[model samples]
Target: MPQKRRYKSRRTNYRRKSNKNNRTTIILIAIVAVFVVSFFGYRRYVQYQSESKVEMVQQDHSQFIKKVSPYAVELGRQYGVLPSITIAQAILESDWGTSSLASQYNNYFGIKGEDPSNTKVLQTKEYTNGQWITINGRFRVYSDFRESMKDHTKLLVDGTTWNSQQYRQVIQSKNYIDAAVALQTDGYATDPGYTNKIIRVIQKYNLKKYDEGIK
Candidate 1:
């Protein structure tokens, strides 16, 4: 009878150990599964945030283009300037109408002026001596973006005070490419890559289509 009782106790002890091991295995598997799920969830969240940012940026750019295209097309047709060139210049110089000059004073073309009452002194970067330098510049202020666009078109048509025929090539160009190169040759901007930058903006946004209403 004593031997039987001892055998029974040993079997019970073995079963308890087996059950403890199984419980431990289940706990470890559950932990691993939780970790994998959390990692993938976090990855998906990050991806969603990145896509949202891209979509917002694209929407902002589209809005800017829509707001400016009508004025550009109208002014281009009246003044014989390519709307693509005008719109591209506005986008590049004003950073999609977000720059201080564009947002506050409505100066989209960065036109400098000397009038004390009609000009705002602002810091501007110039590509000079093969390097970019920040300098104080007096820029003309306008009542609205439409006025700014009108002034810019007039500048191209009437030219600067020193030379009345400075931007003649820009108005006479047959296509966006020629107009972009003419702007550089006509000294509209000092940056060495100004022509290429203008061309890239026009191409990226398909700004040439705005010129369809004109000749």
Candidate 2:
């Protein structure tokens, strides 16, 4: 009877120890799982914040055309030009007014000049010998965006003495499409698809109503 009692006590002790170890292991496993879930959840929260900021910035840029269009329409009307084409050209040439030249000096149209006081030397692209080449050139600078818009409109209507012929067809065009084509045909830009780019900008912004005098 004494031996039987000792054996039973030993067996009970062993089972009790095993149960305690198993409970400790389960607790540790639960702690690790909670930690892993928390870490990933925080990472996802940070990623969402970053993405939201970028989306807001992009939305601001997309609204640039709407913000600057009133000035474009006014300048276009003053010069007897189509506002839609003028605004589209501004959007494409200036990259919605985010280009280095446009941002720095308000030179949105990339007009070249020799004036010492209002000129900036920059590398520009030129098509030569069936290929495009980069060359250092002087571009006109403006004090403000308004000045740049006025000058750009005037340039299209009344070009320089040496290049007035280039804008003759453009100034004479009665519609936006014809104006875009005339600008392209007269080498307004080096891009082969400059006319298409202008048209695309106009369509994307729904700018044709300006040509129809719609508010």
Candidate 3:
């Protein structure tokens, strides 16, 4: 009877040990599953953020087009400047009116002015001596978007210098392509690819349609 009792006690201890081992194995598997799920969850979160940013970029583009297209058409009809080039330049220069200069002062054309009352002092990158240099430039400030557009058209039409004929080619050009090329040819912009950039913006936004159906 003592031997039987001893054997029963050993059996009970072995069962307890087996139960502990099984519990440990289950806990390890649970931890691994949690880790795998967390890793995939993080990846999905990152992908969602990237896609959201892309969507926001597209939204920004459409919003810009909606805001500026009508004004561009009106300005072109009044000032004889190519509407496509005008809108494209506004996009390129002001980054769809998102730049600090445009935001603070409504200065879309980068027009310089000495008026102390309506101006924004901005750090500009100028190409000088075959290199780019940062300089503080005073940009003209306007009361509204229409004023800004008016000022830009005035500059291209009347020109900045006393000689109001600095960019005559642009004013005389019949199409957006000619005006874009003329802007570069007449040293309106320092960048070598300025014309291409303007043309690219016009094409990307389908701004030529604004020029259409206008007398």
Best by lDDT: 1
Q: Global lDDT for candidate 2?
A: 0.83
After superposing all C-alphas onto the true structure, candidate 2 shows an RMSD in angstroms of: 3.9
Quote the positional error of residue 88 for candidate 3 in Å.
Answer: 1.3
- Could you say which candidate leads in TM-score? 1
The reply for model 3, stretches above 4 Å from the true place, is 1-21
lDDT of 2 by residue, 35-104 (tens): 9999999899999999999998678666876766788888766777788877787777788788888899
* Candidate 2: count of backbone clashes, pairs at least 3 residues apart or interchain: 0
TM-score of model 2 vs. true structure: 0.75
Q: Taking the tens digit of each residue's C-alpha lDDT, what string does model 1 give over 12-46?
A: 99999999999999999999999999999999999
User: How does candidate 1 fare on TM-score?
Assistant: 0.88
Report every candidate's CA lDDT: 0.93, 0.83, 0.86
C-alpha positional error of residue 21 in candidate 3 after TM-score superposition, expressed in Å: 4.5
Flag regions of model 1 displaced more than 4 Å. 1-24
TM-scores of the models, in the given order? 0.88, 0.75, 0.84
The window of 10 residues in a row where model 2 has the poorest summed lDDT is: 206-215
lDDT of 3 by residue, 1-215 (tens): 99999999999999999999999999999999999999999999999999999999989888877887788888888888878888898888898889988877787778889888987788998888888899999888888877888888888889866768988999898778998999999888888789999988888878888878553
Q: Report clashes for each candidate as comma-separated counts.
A: 0, 0, 0
Residue 70 of model 3, lDDT score:
83
